[model samples]
Target: MNKVKLKIGEFSQMMQVTVKTLRHYEQMGILKPCEVDQWTGYRYYKLEQMQRLGAIRRLKDIGFSLDEIRELFEEGSHEPNEAQLEEKIKACEEELKVLLKRRENLHQMIDSQRKFKSMEKFSIQSLPEIMVASHREVIKNYQAIGDMCCNVIGPEMQRLGCKCSATGYCFTIEHNKEYKPEDVDIEYCEQVEEMLKDSEIIQFKKMPAVKTALCLKHIGPYDRFYQSYTEMFKYIEEQGYKIVGDLRCVYVDGIWNQDDPEKWLSIIQVPVEK
Candidate 1:
């Protein structure tokens, strides 16, 4: 009877794997050769061992860990169990998704920091309470507010021959917890030279008297608007002031059609007291 066996060098070449990799796999117990000569200390592999080596290489290509590949080989077949493979695939997918979201959040934070660095020096100014014509709507869906602003509010402001003197968008917090993006109650308002009367488009809403904040000026895209708010809050705390009322974002420019970040003028306001 003839025994078909190849030396380690020949087996490595035939299996398209480096000799060092084969030795490492042997140490890992995933790939054991047919026999090893005790006197010569030489490794020999049978031709049938080629199949398992190929399976190990394929699993490695698919990002499988050494331990996972060991488990696969311990099952004693070239094909792994379908359920186990599926579970690994799902785990890898979930990890990828989390990494992608973290990357996006980092990008947003960097953009905000850059914007704050370029802004003019902000100051604290006390603004008197003024009556503002307003309307309230229960927002079940957040998308509806954006639609109302663009489609309804934008057009209605133009129709009433009213230009925004000081416009703001605020959300009333139900509890002390941060408002979820989707569950926020958005209040959009614009200040005019004089309150309109007997007009269908303009409605009278009372704005309570309270000591509030006045920030310098911000001109940019709304995506990074939160930066201004964050800086303002930090300044407020540093000056030993406490927030007394709801926050507001006042618009100095009525034109929202401009795409340039430099042209959009907005002022972020916070109600505060000593």
Candidate 2:
């Protein structure tokens, strides 16, 4: 009986792996051929290397990166040291946490898309003035909107024992001309029965009503608000309306009011000039 050494092509075919992947593994220093012909620079692998290749495939399937794989194999044996195994296991756990968050976000987006396939066109309307408790913050992400509302506005309301207006009118006044999720200068206001004592975090202020504006109702997640805006802006320009003031995003249902993104409803109000 004689041991067989297979060329790269033969090894790839027998291992049921792509040649490209094999080359990548070789470059990553995790795998190498048993012999290379000097004249032609061809790689050859012995039958014994099959077990190592199988181990590499399994490790990849378990979410180990090439760098991690390199570290694992740098021990000169497939038998992983405790520190190596611990590091890989820790990495896998961190990746799983990120994946779970991404999965949840996808579910919210998918659910919202299914809820509203089409958004309503912008309609011109007059907005009435209202007194509100307002706060402005420069935050890193849009999700901070909810955090500020919960931590600042909600607490202020509770501290004052204030009564909310029957209108349920709560909105964020976007100061930026365009949507900038990070470093957003938004003034969030919620209508109240009466103004409470001014606080550094949140203050009672009045929103000067709009005489005319382009308004569109968004009936899904905030992430899908872009869709409504895309359609609304088209309608606005076609109608000959020039935007005059910062946009107002009125929240009818949001994270505070609804658990499912499908139930969220927002109204985008673009103050416009005739």
Candidate 3:
């Protein structure tokens, strides 16, 4: 064979790379033309150079940057070290794990949005006073609400053989002056018709009747309960009422009664002053 030589344009077409990319690779010292015309200053490449261009594209498709591709090409035989390749694979795996978690959170948010469309109508109601067996804690996070309820308080009540009252109004009181996921002050109260022995964490107490509260029925995961809060406050602002006390959330159905998040029911109430 005459050892074919092609102009830069012809070689670019043959290798499926743009002229600009060829010039960039030349500047990056990854790919270079075989000849430059002394008079017209045109660049030319040999047909054999297509193999190098193919290698560049292959490395790029596998997420290698131009610097990495040049280092790969400089590795004597155009084959990367096994250790370096393994490190790259490990980094990619970590990135994939992060992306998977983000995708899961996105789905949860989308599901929450779908559930909010059927929000229940709210009312400003005069809530009656209630007596209860209760446990209060300043927790680290919102999940601690479930942790303290399921692990500590519920088990303790069962151990003591205390039964829920016939009325069965179980609710939580948030005592934080402002909403903060961390360092949350929570009071878990369950109506118990009879008296029971008390621990420092658990006691009997009364939640005073509210003259007026913006209350809404929420049916979904506790994580999505903020939608209820949003709607409740919107109504409160519309009616010209100032928030007077901590938010009150009554749990009608929860993990203790049901396994499905969609089946959980909460009544969110905000005390307001007219």
Q: Using lDDT as the measure, which candidate wins?
A: 2
Write the residue-wise lDDT of candidate 3 on 192-231 in tens digits: 7677788766787667888888888887777777777787
Candidate number with greatest TM-score: 3
On the 0 to 100 scale, the lDDT of residue 24 in model 3 is 92
lDDT, candidate 1, 112-198, per-residue tens: 457656877575666655555454444555445445666766677677766445544322222225656555555666555556662
| Model 1 lDDT at residue 178 | 67
Stretches > 4 Å off in candidate 1: 1-111, 120-122, 128-133, 141-144, 166-183, 198-202, 205-235, 251-267
List ranges where model 2 is wrong by over 4 Å: 1-3, 17-44, 62-76, 79-94, 118-162, 172-213, 219-230, 242-247, 254-264, 270-274
lDDT measured at residue 126 in model 2 versus the true structure, 0 to 100: 90
Instruction: Provide C-alpha RMSD values for all models, in order.
Output: 8.8, 5.3, 4.7
User: Cα lDDT of all candidates, in order?
Assistant: 0.67, 0.82, 0.81
Could you tell me every candidate's TM-score relative to the true structure? 0.48, 0.62, 0.69
The sequence of per-residue lDDT tens digits that candidate 2 reaches over residues 1-274 is 8679999999999999889988988887888888889999999998668988988878777667778778768867665667867887898899899999899888887766675566545567898888888888787777777778878779877887768888788888777777786898888888888887987777888788889978888887677778888988888788788888878899988888787766788889888986
The TM-score that candidate 2 achieves is 0.62
Q: 1 or 3, which is superior by TM-score? A: 3
